[model samples]
Target: MQTPDQIWNDADLPTRRLAGLALNPSAPQDVLLRLLADGPLAVRMVLCRDRILPDAVVDAVIEHPDTYTRSFFARNPHVDPAQRARLIDDPEWFVRAHLAEGPRMPSPARPKPLPDEAIVHMISTYEDENMGSLGFYQQISTGLRRSLHTHPVAKVRCWGVGRWSGLSADARAALLADPDADVRERAQRHERYEDPACMERELPARPCHGRTDILLNRALSRAVVDGVLTAPAREDERATIAANPSLPTDVVVLLAADPDPEVRRRIASRADLGPDERRGLAVDPDPKVRLAVSVHPELSEKERAAIDYEVPMDCGFTFRHAPEVPPAPEAVRRDALSAHPLLRRKAAGDHSLPPDLVARLAADEDLGVRVLLAQNHPHAPAPLLLRSFLEYTGRERAHLTTRPNFPTTGLAAFADHEDPEVRALVALDPETGPATVERLTRDPDPAVRAALARHPNLPPPRLAELLDDEELAHVAAANPAWDADTIRRLAAAPLDGRT
Candidate 1:
């Protein structure tokens, strides 16, 4: 809070002087002018970051001999359109790269749209593998998107082709006749794409031709003989009918004794089979039938836990296709108050658990158990959720803050907490008042600023102030407060302005 003169007169570390400069957002133009002219690169960078900068000071920074000094303005949204035009063509590729992404930066008013020519320039040079003027594409009008359908660059035309839903029938027809093979291929492919109704109609009628296809059809009306399918003239057809749960219970029991091992395998997968039948199938000579019984949805929890296939993770394979075993509701409710915290944690998600049990889990000593209660227990009391915020440290507090009914009436206490991470979570809470949000906007931490940058509750003026920060560009673009037209206007560069 020292006077600007004091900052200049008593400089110890340049960073200290810069810190002092940052404290005074409304520092006079003359002071900024001197800093831009005389300050070291770090001090000057900090000067550029201030929300307000005089025209002369901006010009001085732009005219500086060092590429980094000049380049810094390219990423800054406050740079006027005329200044941006000049910076966009700065000799440094780094400068243009920053400007290409500059549209994402916050602006009090929607930024003047980049001309179509500038967009083409950005497409040609500034794009990398990760981002390629994607926000620009999101903002442009449908007509502009269509115009790119025939753009000389294949990549641009390909991007245009991908917006299939937006194209007019006539335009699509023209694309089908396009000289480029890729354009024609995409257009032709889109032309042949069927609507849901058409796809349903085109599906082959019943009495399917292939043995495998016939067996899989759930709708085939075929007769069963003594619990064995007799309609299929073929052996595999009987196996498939045996697998169908629609078959009568007596028919399935008959199929269990069929000569074909495949018939028993099919029966092993049926949902209607009783426990005794499954136990018999579990010991079938065919390993596939035994494996199916082991993983069957009806298998008891203890039974499933005992049937260990190769523990896939221990075998060094990171990805494994395994059946999920959800604990039964009755079992989960029983375990909700168990001495084992892990079992209690697993049971916290059971919707059928008594309300009192849910409250107990919410107050569980383990942080993870409490988090599960917050996420899965809909009836968890407000006091328990608030206690989580007040008692827990780190991100656990943040987790409780996002829960559906977590109390926000008195959450102002955490608004100015020392931890930026905690403050960032508070910023995301929909119930946090605008006054608290506006105060957090001035928070020194960039992480907190980033979180506030797109918070729906943040007042527009405060939201717009964040536009000047390059680090917050993406979040600013995504703020829900912006109406569709406003987003379109702010995100896209227009074609009329040639520069």
Candidate 2:
């Protein structure tokens, strides 16, 4: 047999075709390049996954006649940034859409900023497809601002107004009155401009009323300065600034002394904080601040334990039992469980805990703790818990009934449960037996009776029996299987009788 490299370089069309069948990682790079463009789409697709495909060849395939071939390159993380940039404007919307929606394109070791023309084209084409293209939006916004007075496209100018509505009052007022009606309309409706003074207020000096407009304006300004906004910001803007991961190191460092507890909390949570900063915050005056820092995800278990040791009991317990970190061990877990019922409730819902830990807490004496465990436990045995609660009355049974997957077995067993809520749960269970439905039809709750009357599996005779129960009869009449005759009968049924 020919060596893999020799087979790839055979040059004879039949030999090259045969050689392409060999899936060797060491296949000649030149041969892979030729095959990437000229080979069948499948062969080219496979070649796209090869780490050996040079940047130039990848660039060439990006504009290949076949969209699937271009998509393969677009999805490849190794594809050079320059090539990826060019493909962002591929005439085929599918290819452009794929590029826009694909995983973050890895930037080069020494990446050059995308050109203004390319950035503008990407923003105009792909903004609707993926709003997270923040770099592209920033570039376009910057360019539009520089050329706003004479920008050719009103739509582009309008995009600038919508994008930069978070700017200062003078700047926002100018955009709101721009020549384009759409720009004016967007600015007028803009949530950012609703509060005139919120964005201009200096934080740590004074706090504003927590109005929607004030929050939105402050949040938007903070987001623009920080380069990106996390999906959720904290209640306090000072805390938001201190906790923001994307802020410059200098800016974060300067925020360390911010007087607000929330701001100090954010500083404690900073991933970039050096050992000294961590230590300093570990002993900070504020208990909340110390707790927030101790539970920072960046801190190792050892670091957290150390911080827990140095802190006071209330603060240490808060940090030790914080939802951010996993329960330290069985001993620590027991301590957290014993500290406060609320702490036990928090521990029960900590997603990072082992499933067995959560399962153990699922039967906690506190209904809230059990409810939290049931809700957050990934492996919660719903059937068993529901079954166990079959004999529970009042609020306890009501709580179980609200879970996402209602315990059908337990609920089915409670078909004759005296409480309307339990009987109601059984009536609504998709797995409810015909006998269970019959029992629920007599439930005192009109809602439960109505649910049973409309059940598709309900026997025709049983449904007819409900025709006398006004609310249930009305629900039964709406079922598609109920004929016009059935509806007519239900309409004439007496309102006072039970179904």
Give the TM-score of each candidate: 0.36, 0.37
- The local distance difference test score of each candidate is 0.58, 0.54
lDDT of 1 by residue, 328-368 (tens): 76776756755544456557656456777887787777665
Top model by TM-score, which number? 2
Q: Which stretches of candidate 1 lie over 4 Å from their true place?
A: 1-12, 19-23, 49-52, 78-83, 103-117, 124-159, 178-499
* Candidate No. with top lDDT: 1
Predicted candidate 2 versus true structure: per-residue lDDT over 1-499, tens digit per residue: 3332442344333222212221233344455555665564445554553333566676568657877777666555444445666787688877676565543332211122445565556655565655355444433334455555335566556666654534667767777777788777877656444433344343222343443334333443544444322332344555545554445565566667666667777777777877667777887788777776776546656666665433222211111112323466773475344534544656765646676666667666665566556545545567634643454443334444445555554456667767666567665566777777777777778778866765666777876555444345434533334554443333233333421
Q: Residue 76 of model 2: what lDDT?
A: 55
Decoy 2 TM-score against native: 0.37
**When superposed on Cα atoms, how far off is each prediction in RMSD?**
17.5, 22.4
For model 2, give the 10-residue run with minimal summed lDDT.
313-322
